[model samples]
Target: MSERLTSVPGLLYGGDYNPEQWPEEVWEQDVKLMREAGVTMVTVGVFSWAGLQPGPDTWDFGWLDRLMDLLHAHGIAVDLATATASPPAWLVRAHPEILPVTADGVRLEFGSRQHYCPSSKAYGQAAVRLTRKLAERYGRHPALALWHIHNEYGDHVTECFCPRSAAHFRDWLREKYGTVDALNHAWGTAFWSQRYGTYDEIEPPRTAPGPVNPTQLLDWRRFCSDALLALHRAERDVLTATSPDIPATTNFMSMMRELDYWRWAEHEDLVSDDAYPDPADPRAHVNASMNYDLMRSLKRGRPWLLMEQAPSAVSWRPVNVPKKPGLQRLWSLQAVARGADGIMYFQWRASRAGAEKYHSALLPHRGTASRGWRETVRFGAELARIAEVAGSRVTAPVAVLLDWDSWWALEGADHPSARMRWPDLMRPWYAALHARGITADFVPPHADLTGYRAVLAPNLHLVRSADARRLTSYVRAGGHLVVGPFSGVVDEHDHLHDGGAPGPLREVLGLSVDEFWPVPDADAVPLASGASATLWSEWIETAGAETVDTYAAGPLAGQPAVTRHAYGSGIARYLSCHLPDHIGDVLDAALAEAGVTACVPVPEGVEATVRTGADASYLFLLNHTDRPVAVDADGTDLLTGAPVRGAVRLPPLGAAVLRRPHSPDSLDSPDPANSPDPLGDNRS
Candidate 1:
């Protein structure tokens, strides 16, 4: 068997296909249209648990068998789902105890999907049985390309405060900490007299009067993620045992805080994600790029798949906004530019009736003449033209640190300011880099930073001693480092460091935080560098560093707001305030210090990325603005097969993929970049 999961020859293109929803005559038309749209793969049976198994023992595979056979005959492959995403009403009605209980002690009903608790034994066993049956029936089918595990693991319900889940949490705690004394030490239970004498005393951190124990809340978050993962593993084991060669995957909600993807990615044969960037948000593409980078980085630069995206507008948002004329193709190609091996969507055909009836699809309600259908056909043709870029790689010189543990702890209750969101602080830094045409990868705090020119930790509220040591060594070995506010403040156990804030990183950062003065919402304070800081500011006393900037107003006036220190062979810069407006300036200095530059400079609002294969490198340029722009390049425009010498012109909301002879850039030699071209003629 091949190492790759998708057995298709070129870049895979398709979406979720539900033959059961439509009549038998419509199935024929769907297959014909799939061929016309150049779709090679489709996800089947995602939410078909009810239809597949009407009762506890009854089974129905006649319709599914025919659909599978029809799809195979038409040359379309199947990423078959285990069909356990949502349990059937029969199962839930029979075992009402399996329903999830919210923290308020109300058992949720089964009107919506994903109503079962993660720790419910009845749910897990039923999911495993169905997965095993599917694997046995279609394991050797020619159309079976991949096995999709439970769809979007933690999308609707992440945590369940029911008695079953509470028991599972206690079991998990027992395994992690052998004794109650150790658990008390880890949770710092001495503060509120919340010490635990036995594992049975601990619960899932249900609703409390004032504030829950921070450490218990953190552990609850951890347990919730693991519980869902355990459920996935149960079904995965069945699939793998039945069809060992076929790869298995589950679609991840991009950057979801409910599950720790880094830990979950370890079990996946192929990393895949479902991305839905709002059409209303102008800067949505920037955040999407970060999410795409995280997906690729989950498997250490291995090529991943774009499991699902909106063809146009999504129904879930308050104000549903449709994609403009060329916006769909532009954003889809952006995923390829970031590192997606394939592009797929949430659905194939628009539903006639459902909660998602308004969600856009490849074959819309207006049929072939619709703008969405026409655009889909055109985009599929374009993907086929540049199929050679499928297995290519993207490389980056910088890494942004992301840790789910820190995210859970930082966003928990009783912090310096509730206004300080993890992603809010991260977006400005990443957006600055995207604007600079510089690519970056998201890595864990303990990830190896050997090849990266510079590393940035936006906020590591929870850092382990080992992670701090690795970072210290990286800086000592001539790697530029930048750490944001409130970092190194606590250990993994959520206990404050001995000296103060910036615990283990104090020596490397060359400063100590005396106090955290968080400004009120919509308030700003003056900085000595002429840039105003908002949301967060810290009083600092430098140990062995040079003060870069100081607060000019407020109680912390004249105090250092930003500082730089000379470590072993490199420099460590610290930003002690929320400086979204001036992050680009700080990053520019770090880039200069680390000798990192953009892959190829382009005009503002134009995105530039490169993917390198063994023989050649492909340069991708995307014009995100409403006007045409020219970017310097030298190679063949893969979309048109036209040779380019100097520059390539991209129209409004346009893109270009140029295939050139490979030239190894030293900084990103080990990392990889994402996907391709838009124009037919070379006219710069």
Candidate 2:
């Protein structure tokens, strides 16, 4: 077995292949082209359940068998598909109860993927049977490398409101609190004269548009996530029984809402995800990078697979924008640099017809000589060249803490600051770190942060008691901590703690928020740079903590928009307002004072990142803009196959990997201005 196909520290290539869609003649040609492109693995049968199991008892594995055999004969490893994404029409028609009923009381038609009710007994039985059948047949196959469960499990058009799902929701509530009284107390159902006397009286939260209760809607979201996790666990148990050796996983959509990934990761053998961001979007890098970090942290720093990336444009979004030249390669390496062990795209070949005909692939409609094909070849060759060297490398000395409990709590609150939006507040801090090439993991709040020198907690609305203790201890031990404005407002149950703003973190952060000034719009209070903070919402005040910066010109001019607190040997900084470029610079300078250095020393528009291992270090320098950038060379240039003695310029959308000699003290290396570039590319 090749290490590239089955081990850590070796990159795996290739992606979703639908050889069954094309003629047998094209299959051989596809294999030859894949080999030439350095492709090593293929994912099969993701959307083929409708074609495979047409009836409850009927299964046509002939095509799958032949497909696997053909791939195996070519020495291509197979990520065998479970064919559970879309159930067949017969199953839906036979058991109409399996259909999902939306929140609006409309019964969804069985037309797309993820349409089956996860809580339905019929669906579970059928799914388990199909999974067992597939596993029993392919469990002993020599070509099987991994098991890819339902494709992008929660990215579908249905939300279940059927009676079965409602009953499951009730049962889930029972398990969560062990009694209806406890549940009623947590939900505060008595407020609107909505009290449940019996289990049957409780229903999944479904409300029409207008004057709805936020608590009810929040509980419904929580219940639905739990109900779906049960389905995942059931399927996982079936596969684990049949083929215990093979790893099983479902692809996650980055930063998705419906499914609780932290809980889902507990049942998966490995984490995998699909990433598709708009090419023209300015926040594309942060969006993709945050998702990669979230996936990596889900398994506690374990490597994950980039299961489905767009080789070009995706067809589903209203606007299908193509990735610019070198963009795909940059994003692929971004995943690997973050901690991905494998890189693959959605479709290996362009579909001749259907919903995704416009999706990009290695071999476009014009065949192998086109721009898409050439870019794929170049990316593949580069991946193969560094496949062995870049495997299993980890990056960064700092990590950011992210918690699902906090996410749920923030959204679950009835009195949540209308001004606070979680994603918007978190993105800027994440982007600031990414621009400097720092690799930060998104660990849960409960994760141990003792190893990290700095911890950034953005919009930490929910603060558990234990987490507060841990954070206090971390800061007291000389570690730096950053807390965003709306942090520490609620407890685990989404209720105000009655102490003050920030609850338990109030004492640790040495700040108590007395009032919040909600800006009417981005123009209401602009940054010092004269740019409006587009998504900024609330500006808070610290009653006791020392003010670091105030609004430059506004009605609340001298109010504390940013504060700092001294806690033992360390310091805690609280950001109260949405900081545009000017305020962001002040915050960045504050972080520098706390002993955190920029991951890369380049100017804006150029993205810098570093990945390291015990024996090697790799620095990534990328130009994110359309125009070229002149960068000072620092080490051996892996992409250009040359080293520069001083300043070097990179073309538009260019990227390079600089390999530096490893040292045990690399993490503690002094300022770059004092240390010479060991590879003779120093710049004065």
Candidate 3:
């Protein structure tokens, strides 16, 4: 098996296929129609636990075996599912304790998918049994390209506060801390007389009197995430042992609040994600862009697959809006622009029954004659035109740090303000970078920062002492660092740093935050730089740091609102309030200091991203505005084969791929009538 989906000629384009839902004869027709749309692969058996194993003692693989063989005959590869996403009724009845419990102490009955407790021994045994059975059966199946693990780990049952979970939590704590004393000290258990005499005294943080211990709550989240990850590891190891050549993966949700993806990524051979940006959201592309970038960065800039995206309107939202004409194609290419190797959807054909019956699929209920089917064919054809993009990567000079530990600890129930949303607070920085046409890789806090010219630290509330040292070293060694508000407040253990805010980084930042005020009811305050700030504000005293911006007309009027401190060969800047409207100016100044600038100047709403192949570089231009905008880009438009020299007009919501010629300064003549061979060299 190939490491990536690029084993074939072009970018892999296909989605989930459930043959059990239709007649056996319809499977052939499904394969024929799919091949017509240029699909290369399909993920089967995502939610087929009940269908695959109708009973604990009884097994049925006839339907799936025939389907796989049928797809292989059609030259379509497979991303086979383990059929463990949803347990069958017989298994649940045998071991009722496998059902999960809510934090409110309700034992959820098994009526939906993902109802089993992740930490249940009985459930684990069943998962292992199912995985081994699938691996032995499909170990060398020619159609098998990838192994899809249990679907969406935390989709339904996020956390299980049952007795089984409690036991697992205790075991995990003992392993992580090694000793009870170490655990107590790290948790600062003395705060609320919450110190446990022994490990058995500790229980998963459930309903508590008043506010729960912040340490206990944070640990519970970690434990819950670990439980899910352990399940994936067990199943993944089984498949790898059976067929070491085949890569294993599960569809990860980008913004899932549970099951921290950063921790789960190491277990995956390659990265894959299910992206469902609400069509109703006007800023959906911005959200999708970040997700695509994050997914690519998970494996250090390796190409990933867009496992699930809607071809039309989704049925879940309040007012499920259909995708605007050309929007799906634009979004699909947008993912490719950001380093997605394959484009796939949730279902191959629309569901006629079940929970997601109304979810959009490549083949809608109207079948081959529908607009959804037409768009699928058109997009598939476009992918066929740019096969060189596969195995390539998108690299940038800036990194926006994404720390899951910080997110887990920062906005606990009892903080300066529980309303301080870490995710929302981090969005402005991302949006600012996007608006400037500067692509940034999402990295962990301790990742190598030497490659990036500038690093943005936003709401990094949980930084260990070692992490703080590494960050200071990055800045002192001549890299621009932008520290967002409420950063560096606590250590890795969720305990506040002894002295003040921003802890070990206070000196490098040349400032100290003595007080934090939760002013949710306060209005936006004016910055001396002529911009306004909102939501969060902090009081700080500078220690030899220059005040680049200050509060203009608030209670702390004329005080230092934003400060910059030069340390060694670099500069460290701090923002006391949430990023303001003048953020572009602030970032541009840092970017200029770091010897970097926007990739190229383009009108607002036109997103730009570049993917560099081994022998050529491909630039993707997307026009997101309402009207066609002229771009000062010079390259052969791969879509039309036209050599663009001075300016080209891009239709609204339209996309174009430009493969740059060898000479950066010269625009080579183009063959407008011919499509570039996807496997050929970069030529015009």
Candidate 4:
């Protein structure tokens, strides 16, 4: 199965198909239409639990059998569903403990998918039984290309406070800290009058107004994440025991707060995600770019599937905003530019009733006669044309260090500042790279850094000794390293390392931080480029670092907000403030000094991305705006099959791919003087 998938030309094209919702006669028509549109796969049984097992004790496989047989008779492969997204109504009613408990201690009713209690014994047992049953029945089937686990786990509100959850939390604590004393020290319960004499006394943190304990909330988040992972593992173990060759994956919501996907990535055969960008929002590129990097990095540069993107607009979101013309196809190509192996939509055909009835689909309510269908066919044709050339292409030379343990450790600390949010600190640097047409892979802190030329670690609050050594060696070998301010404050156990700010990394970074300035009420700090920026806090370096930039005009004026240190033939740059556009120029200069630059030329309000393989190179030029712009490049336009010798005009929100001849010096050929400078634009 893996070999077959790897040998496929370009990205796989297909999506979710629910034949149980329609009559048997309609199935043939649907298959005919899908083949006409170049669909090669169909996901089955996503929301079929109600149909598969109508009662608590009885199970039926007749409908699923017919559906699978029909799909296999055609040439379309199948991503077999686990049917565990939602339990039958009888099972939920019979075992009420399966329902989830909210953070406020409220038990929810069983009405929606992903509402099952993670810690419930009955729920876990039932899920395991059903999963094994399904695996045993169809694991050896030839058409099963992948194992699709329960759909989109942990999308709703999280945290369970029931008796089962409480007991599991106690057990998890025992395994983590071994004793109450160690737990107390890590959580810093001494200041809150919340010292625990016994494990049973611990409780999940409740939302309140002031001075809440960060450690307690952090542990609760970790516990919730682990609980869901256990559910995933339970299902995966059963599937693998039966069908070891089929890849197993659960579709993830990118950067979701409830489940830590980094931890979950270790258990799956491959990573898959659902991406739905808000069309009304102007920063859709920023959001989509972040998720693409995240998905790619989850498997350490292995290709992942875009499991669920709306064909047009989603019905569940309030207002049901439609994707502007050309945006859907552009976004699909954007996914390929990152590292998606397959592009699939949520629903192949729009539903006639239910919560998602209004969701747009390839075959909309008007069938194959409307603008939606026309666009779908056009995109399908485009994909077929480029399929042979785009397959197996890789992106980027730069890497970003993302530590899951670091994320957990920082959020678990007993810090004094309320403004230190993790995502806000990481987003700026990520956006900086994306705006420059550079693809940055999100690597785990402990990952091998032998091939990368530049490394960016943003808000890496936790530092492992082994990872520090690797970074040191990479720098010593003449690789660039960029470490942000809130780094190296804690260890894996969420406990302070204690020597100085940045702890173990201080030696490698060559800086000794004295204190951090928690800017509580300061307005946006003006930059030299006439832009203002806001930051949560800025680190005040007292000694042992060269100041690169300072606050332009404020109480902190003339104080260093950015610093750089030379170490072993390489350098380390530390950004101390929330960077505005002006600071991006400084970052670009640093990147240039390190002998790395953006892959393509970027225009204002346009996204420039590059994907390359052994025999072909693709340059994606995307205009992410409402107005048209002129673009000029030196290559053959892939879409038009014509030589692009000079300036080319682009329409509003349009995209074009240039198929340049592949060579060792292709990246270096576009001279800085002739190319549009990415750092000159600040719109992103």
Every candidate's lDDT: 0.89, 0.73, 0.84, 0.75
Cα RMSD to native, each candidate?
A: 5.0, 5.7, 5.3, 5.3
Arranged by lDDT, best first: 1, 3, 4, 2
lDDT of 3 at 385: 85
lDDT of 3 at 95: 96
Q: Which TM-score value belongs to model 3?
A: 0.95
Tens digit per residue, CA lDDT, model 2, 1-684: 121224323577888998768887888889888888878788999888877887777889998888788877887888888888777889899998888888888887876677788788988888878888899999878778888887776677435877888888788778877877887777677777767777778877676545455555666667777767776777778888898887888888988867777778878778888999789797797788889888877766666888998988988887888988889988888787677778989879999987788899878888987999998888888887666444344544567767766776665533434555667677778877777666677766666665566788877887877778878887888878888766787766666668757788887677777755656554556544453443343455565468766666666665566678778888788876666454456447556756667665776777776665445566777777778887776667766667755665777777777777766666664222222111121111
Q: What tens digits encode model 1's per-residue C-alpha lDDT throughout 1-684?
A: 232447888889999998888999999999999999999999999999988898999999999999999999999999999999899888998999889999999888998889989999999899999999899999999999999998999888998999999899999999999899999999989988998888889988888888999989999999999999999999889988999988899999999988999889989999999999998999999999999989888877767999999999999998999999999999999998887889999799999988999999999989998999999999999999888888777878899999999999889888889987899999899999999999988888777777788999989888888788888988999999999998898888888888988999998999899888898988998998898999999988999989988999889889999899999998999999989989898889989999999989999899999887767888888889999999888899887889888999889998888997756565434423322111112211
Error of 2 at 340 (Å): 1.9
TM-score of every candidate? 0.97, 0.91, 0.95, 0.90
Taking the tens digit of each residue's C-alpha lDDT, what string does model 4 give over 1-684? 131242335667878898877889989899888878888777888888888778877889987787777777787778889988887788888988888887677888877676788888887888888888889988877677888999898777456787788889989999989999999888888876878998889866655656567666667778888988898899999998898878889999987766777778888777888999988888887889889878877765566888989989898777879887788888888887676778889888888978788999888889988888888878877777666444344555677777655776665534745556677777777778777777777777766665566888878887876677777877877888888767877665566668756777776677766666555556577644454546534646635568877767766677677777788877887766555445466568678977776665667777776655555667778788788887767677776777777765668877777777768767744321222111121211
Candidate 1: Cα lDDT at 377: 99
Could you tell me the lDDT of residue 301 within candidate 4?
57
lDDT for each residue of candidate 3 in 84-175, tens digit (9 for 90 to 100): 87888899999999999988899999887898998889889998998899899997999998899999989888789899899899999999
Q: Best to worst by TM-score, what's the order?
A: 1, 3, 2, 4
* lDDT, residue 57, candidate 2: 76
